[model samples]
Target: MAVQDGPHQASPRKEPGCLRGLVALVVFVGIIYAIWWFTGGRDGDDEASSTPSVSASATGDRGGSSGEWKAGDCGGPDPDRAPDGYEAYDCGDPDATFRALKIMDGSILPAAVQCPAGTDVIIEVSMNSGSDVKPSGGIPTDTVCGRNLSGDHPGDAGAGGGQLVKGDCVTADVEEIACDQAGPGDLKVLGLVDAGSARCPSGTTDPIRLTIVVGRPYDTVCGREP
Candidate 1:
């Protein structure tokens, strides 16, 4: 006698619960991004990545001289911000060094240049800045300069580290408002320039060969513009 065939069976049904679990996972990820966007986290990142190529701080403007920067104006790169912002300081202040003479034209920055007459010190800077956060073969990756590190203050000075606004009486030695707000000895901070001391735009002169201590003052040159 021939053997009989076995009974056919239906395929197992798919689990509805498993399908719902996958949908929940996607929803959880969406919520996370929404929170980051609302808390100002997204804006900060955009400024860094989308920030304009680079510009020397002439006046108060980001790029292109706005006349905010003057011959006697001084300040250093802001260590606190990414693509560091510049701040202004009183003349002869220790924290303030670089003085704006005038804007020069050229893709290649001059190694040394004279400042306008009557100006004393020069804080020359250069760096190859593009979209890269890190300086490449000739680009600069960082631009922080000053007495202490970011988030730190020289408590001995009495004044904390911050951007000095115009009219704030500051010390000529840069003890930073440690003394009285007024006196013949003190000068008022005009505006801030937080762009220097970092990497320069492409074609910037080499700091070593061109001179200038990155962000520190350049005492040798005077009375000419780059």
Candidate 2:
């Protein structure tokens, strides 16, 4: 005999493969993430570690007396020093106005020093007071024998204006000037004579003597009247 029907209870619905499918999907996603993390994703960190750092001094961003300067290096006038001092610059840069011929220790006095034959100007860097035409006594000073690239005279520190090259044209007073600006009476440089030698090239009409500093052997510039 059938019993009286009690309240019918719904059995719990079971997903046959839904749970397993969800687990597999989670594992697949994790594997993909792991592969990405181990391969291309890790390259960022490796590249960051391998990259080289740029120094402020090399780019002349320090903007003051602090930086590495050497012979044959070119530079511009430092704005901080205003009418004096020098800042690092690329030789090929248009702003480059001076080329270093020699660097001397501070122990020597600027008055007692003689720069190289081709040096057109001199600059003094004081360790205690930045860059100055004159350094305070007893401090570390760096003397820069520089060749002025600009045609203008570099104040009193300059011997004259710019140093003359073989192809340069100069005025009758022995001042270097632009070739195009040369007048009918201007002279053209034929060659340069050594410090000890007085004889210029065979065709040199004028042998002009050039002096960089006191007591140093002077060079002779051979020039021909234009």
Give the TM-scores of the predictions, in the order they appear.
0.21, 0.41
TM-score, candidate 1, is 0.21
| Candidate 1 accuracy as lDDT | 0.33
Give the residue spans of candidate 2 off by over 4 A: 1-68, 71-77, 88-123, 126-161, 209-213
Best by TM-score: 2
Residue 178 in candidate 1, Cα distance off native in Å: 35
Model 2: per-residue Cα lDDT at residue 142: 58
**What clash count goes with each model?**
14, 0
Candidate 2, position 92, lDDT:
88
Q: What range of 10 consecutive residues in model 2 has the weakest lDDT sum? A: 47-56
